[model samples]
Target: MSEKQEHASAYWKENLKYLIILLTIWFVVSFGCGILFREALNEIRLGGFKLGFWFAQQGSIYVFVILIFVYVRLMNKLDKKYGFDE
Candidate 1:
């Protein structure tokens, strides 16, 4: 393959690893800690809000929003690095 193709492929491979890790963390924090293990987490409270309830109702949503921005920023950097951004 050409050098450009090699660079692009490498870039994608690296980025995919980051994406997978970020998604996994997202899933665990949102689903596992929030919905599934909520009762267990209820033993802990922060500022009048239960940990699980906060995660379920607000924390997860906030994290998701942040994740979107993080993805956008990362993809922008990736695009620029790969010469895909104009």
Candidate 2:
């Protein structure tokens, strides 16, 4: 492949890697905490709310937002590194 093509491919691969990792975290927080480990997590309290309940109702959304920011920042850095940020 040409140099430009190689850079584009590498950028996409890195982007996908980050996307998969972030989504996995989302699934674990939303599904795993909300369902699979709810009972166990309920035994703990956070901000006076059950951990699992919080994760189900609020925490997951918060995490999703944070992940959005994380992705944006990472992509910006990646773009700069790949000479695509201009």
Candidate 3:
């Protein structure tokens, strides 16, 4: 294979690893903590909001938005690195 193709393949492999890790964290925090462990977290409160309630209502959504932006930024960087930027 050509050097360019090899580099692109390697870049994609690395990017996929990062994406998987980030997505796993997102899932765990939003689903695990917010839903599964919600009762355990209910004992804590912050700024008039119960921890579990906040996570279920607003925190997860906020995290999802941040994750979207993070994905966009990472993909943009990946595109540039792989000469796929438009």
Candidate 4:
């Protein structure tokens, strides 16, 4: 492949890597904590609420929002690194 094509391919690969990692985290927190490990997590408390219940109702959404910011920051850096930033 040409230099430009190689660069673009590398950028896409890195982007997909980030996406997979972040989505995996999302899935683990949303599903694993919320369902699979809920009973175990419920043994703890968060702000007077059951940890698992909190995760089920609020924590995952909070995590998703935080992940959005994290993704934006990561992409901005990636874009700058790839000369795709303004």
Q: Which candidate has the top score in lDDT?
A: 4
The digit string of per-residue lDDT tens for model 1 on 1-86 reads 99989998989897898799889889998998899999999999978999999999888888988988998899899889888898
> Candidate 3, residues 33-65: lDDT per residue as tens digits?
799989988899978878998898888888888
| Model number with the top TM-score | 4
Please give, for residues 1-86, the per-residue lDDT of candidate 2 as tens digits: 89889989999999999999999999999999988999999999999999999999998999999999999999999999998887
Q: Count the backbone clashes (under 3 Å) in each candidate.
A: 0, 0, 0, 0
TM-score of each: 0.79, 0.94, 0.79, 0.96
Angstrom error at residue 59, model 2: 0.6
Error of 4 at 53 (Å): 0.7
How far out, in Å, is residue 11 in model 3?
Answer: 2.5
Better of 3 and 4 by lDDT: 4
| Alpha-carbon RMSD of each model | 1.9, 0.9, 1.9, 0.7
**Residue pairs in steric clash, candidate 1?**
none
Candidate 2's displacement at residue 51, Å, is 1.1
The regions of model 1 sitting more than 4 angstroms off are: none
**Candidate 3 TM-score, true structure as reference:** 0.79
Which residue pairs show backbone clashes in model 3? Answer: none
Candidate 4 off by > 4 Å = none
Candidate closer to the true structure by lDDT (higher is better), 1 or 4: 4
